[model samples]
Target: MTASFEGLSTSAALELLSVGELTPTGRLTEASNATLYCTVAAPGGAEAGCVYKPVAGERPLWDFPEGTLAGRELSAFAVSDALGWDVVPPTVHRDGPFGEGMVQLWIDGDTGVDLVDLARDTRHAGLRRMAVLDAVINNSDRKVGHLLPTPSGHLYGCDHGVSFAEDYKLRTVLWQWQGEPLTGEALEGLAQLEERLRDPDSPVAAELRRHLTGPEGYAVLRRVRLLLHHRVHPYPSPDWPAVPWPPV
Candidate 1:
């Protein structure tokens, strides 16, 4: 298995994903969208595995009428980067062989840990941070299958194409922390997110605006603020389904 690429700084990983020559190693057939497993080599330098998802390859979903799933992927990464949560991997919106798309650093997930068991394992700090992250991103799909647990104990997630919607729609299998008091780390992350997003010209806000609608961009700030105000894990929204279909 390839290294999870966790050692690289976020900037270095972003650079590789942005300018590295992408060569498709294989296709992720299990993915709903066109997901290509690729190797990206930087100019005369570093190389790593990544996943490429082209925007044109996305099919219309009834609830998520907004186009540009690739952009949303980058947008999700922006928030995660700002929070320093590492919930999402280093991702970028760039042109690929299939056209403009999202490229994310590949993570070699440790498959020995059963996801169903992991989902209910609230004692894990990474899972808790993810719950707070899903709340901030307004993630509408956070299935157990999306979790990527590395052997080094870093947890990453994928398939964030349906995130950062203007409306309240957070579906996930991470409800174990519901109504629990926010941990110090989670509070710090949320504080950082709120501070970064409040500035319109901040890199995080700018990236969000580039990908999401004006209202959606504002909604991101609102979500962060709500989390800070509550100072507790969010409960499932009554208006939407509490969890994702095919949960695992």
Candidate 2:
């Protein structure tokens, strides 16, 4: 029961995670940074399990600015919401018991699914959407284990704290579609995204600017433009490692 996020509607999930009382129930110790498993109860008594990653607990990365990981996670959710891709679960940034952090609805995925098999199948529509998302955000980490497949056949990805860097640092396990044309859905989404980015006053652009530095926010627009121009899935960068370490 602790793992299930069933029945948490998108609106309810966002409201609960944003304004609910967060209590740390446990910790996800395998994570490189401190990742707490928490239960958040809304004012109306609705409760659900969630993951909390405090900015204070983030480990400093040589390539990333320290204490910005939590913001990046929230930024990813904002972009996912804008693209209507449903690739990221409900996430919010607020002051938690430990300080300011990100709280995301816990996803109890179907464990029977095999990530290795899924990663190699570029034809899978959900995975392709995720790949395109990574390219747009310049995701630096996309391990197979990050894939969350639900019993309902919805696939979500997490751990986007390292994404949206100004530099093109896309490292992921889903690379089977390299140099292939993007799906029609992706092209349409990218066009809308470009339009939103072009308008500095757009809500999506404002949300991204709230979390990302000016350069980083501009980089997201640039990446989206590149995707539309090439109209193909990105090829792995020769300078950077194509895939994340310990892929699974």
Candidate 3:
């Protein structure tokens, strides 16, 4: 088994992913999208395993534009970084084994953590952050399987291609904090996201604007503002499914 990546910050991982030579190791057969496991080799012989989702391999969805799923993955990471929550793993969009696609540092988390149980627990700090993130991006699918717990207990989420629609479509299994007030950390994270999005010169905004439509970016900022104004967790949409199918 590939070992957990160690001693690398998010920036370092992104740099390696952007410039590394990607070698396909295997395909993740369970995913509906064309997902592959790749080995990234740096010029100096440093190596890491990563998940690659090439645009060419994306299954067409009627709702999302063709060839945009990879970009959404990058955008999701951008928002996560801007929030300083570090919920999503380090991800980048670049040329891959199949073609240009999304490449993310593989999180080799501990196999024993029950993410479903964590999502169910109202007081779990990590899940609270993730829930807030889902609300900001209007995540359409926050399946329990997307949440991974590291051996050191840090939480990471993956497969964010279905997020950030211009419309309200937040479907998730993280309703444990429903009707509760936003914690201080959650409020602070929303503030950071709002500030970054409002600055046209911000690198985070620039990167996300490149990937998401103008309305989509605006929707994210609007959601943050609404959350800050409400001071409570937003209620699940009555018009859309509250939870993803095959939730786990």
Predicted structure with the largest lDDT when compared to the true one: 2
| lDDT per residue as tens, model 1, 1-248 | 12237567777888888899999989999888999999999887899999999888898888677658889898988888888878898899889999999999888899788888998997998898888889988898999899999888778899999998898999999998899999999888888888889888888999998988888989998888888898999899888999999888
Per residue, candidate 3 scores C-alpha lDDT tens digits across 123-145 of 77888888998999888999988
Q: Considering only N, C-alpha and C atoms within 3 Å, which residue pairs clash in candidate 1?
A: none
What ranking of all candidate models by lDDT puts the best one first?
2, 1, 3
Where does model 1 exceed 4 Å of error?
A: 1-7
In terms of TM-score, which candidate is stronger, 1 or 2?
Answer: 2
Please give the RMSD to the true structure for each candidate, in Å: 2.5, 2.9, 2.8
TM-score, prediction 3 = 0.96
Residue 17 in model 1: lDDT: 89
Q: What is the alpha-carbon lDDT of model 3 when measured against the actual structure?
A: 0.86
- Give candidate 2 regions above 4 Å deviation: 1-5
Candidate closer to the true structure by lDDT (higher is better), 1 or 3 = 1
lDDT of 2 by residue, 1-248 (tens): 01224776687789899988999999999999989999999888899989999988988999987338988998898888878888999999899988998899998888999888988985688899999999988999999999999998888999999998888899999888899998899999999889988998987898888899889999999999999999999999899999889888
TM-score of each: 0.95, 0.95, 0.96
